[model samples]
Target: MTVDSGIQWRVGDALEPITLPPVTRLELIQYAGASGDFNPIHTIDAEAEKAGLPGVIAHGMLTMAKISRLFSPYLKYGWVRDFYTRFVGKVFVDDVIMIGASVAEKEEKGAETVYWFEVIAQNRKEEHVAVGELTFLV
Candidate 1:
């Protein structure tokens, strides 16, 4: 459904995609500091190399957070009831990610509407780095 003052929110409808700033090593370090997940693989090249990684990779939660940005515009209409993410690919420094969401199904219970959404985060190569389901109430 299309709201007069908002974007479409309906089953099988996709929200506009959002591209985020490129991932950088410094940003990784900042994320580690903020999230308190100071794993060296996300901030130290030597540690990542020792772990058989191409280089320091971005944190999975960071990627998940980036994916959530796709829902920012819709929050005014309702609120997210639940969100789950599965990390599929490594996100390296300099990689740009694009995120989007599509409504999968909806249910009406009493005075509330529940929406199930499919969310995705893809890298510059268009590979899915994170994908998830989100529940929203309107």
Candidate 2:
């Protein structure tokens, strides 16, 4: 959803949540090819199992990209100045991720207003797989 840039934002405001579809092996392969991240753990189940993982897992950067989609609306409106995240857990194939964010702080920087959001990426079990902060100039 697009957050209106003209609206007054506060420190406790909640950004809308974004629910992503399940990560599939085919998609992982595609991401691997496109991103040049040909890690067997993200594609070959045998390799992942040998590495002590349950099965083929998704790339951490892929999870970060999925979570970043939540900020696209703001980016499209030129409200986002910068964004980042840290991977805290592994995401496996068939796992569904949900991205959420909340306004942590807001302040005026010169003539611009800056908004800080605490972003989180969680799996179906509500376990956080990634977390970080985003800065936006609005």
Candidate 3:
């Protein structure tokens, strides 16, 4: 891919699917300690089960970060100008997350180009955990 020209061509029509490592209890605990998000549902199995979750769950942000990294190659060094998500379902331990993104549109209003994106994360059973839009300025 080339960058820094007067016009930046669309890098791709669709990105390769990104698959996250399986979610696990130890990973959740480490994420809690590292991120300071010590919610019981993410750290206590009983609390998660009582809350109708299968077990201590991974933080939503942890999953989001994984989704974010999937696009790093395309965005390069630029930060996402607009990024937002809707939580569709919970992710339990051992569930694998599959991330996918496609270009919805591209607009060139002036010197800057705006990439409208669609992204989703799903489990092996095809249940979506999170879905969202991200815009990048090119």
Q: How many residue pairs clash in each candidate?
A: 0, 0, 0
What's the residue-level lDDT of 103 in candidate 1?
92
User: Lowest summed lDDT over 10 consecutive residues: which window, candidate 1?
Assistant: 1-10
Q: How accurate locally, in lDDT, is each candidate?
A: 0.88, 0.85, 0.82
TM-score leader: 1
Q: How good is model 3 by TM-score? A: 0.86
Q: Candidate 2's residue-wise lDDT over 9-110, tens digit each?
A: 798988789888888999999999999999899999999999999999889888877766777776644466677888888898888899998999999878
- Name the lDDT of candidate 1: 0.88
Candidate 3 Cα lDDT to native: 0.82
Candidate 1: tens digits of C-alpha lDDT, residues 59-130: 999999877777777788888889999999989999999998889998889977888999999998899999
The regions of model 2 sitting more than 4 angstroms off are 1-7
Return the TM-score for each candidate structure: 0.90, 0.88, 0.86
Best by lDDT: 1
Instruction: Rank the models by lDDT, top first.
Output: 1, 2, 3
Candidate 3 regions with alpha-carbon error over 4 angstroms: 1-12, 75-77
Clashing pairs in 3: none
Pick by lDDT: 1 or 3, better one: 1
Displacement of the residue 28 alpha carbon in candidate 1, Å: 1.0
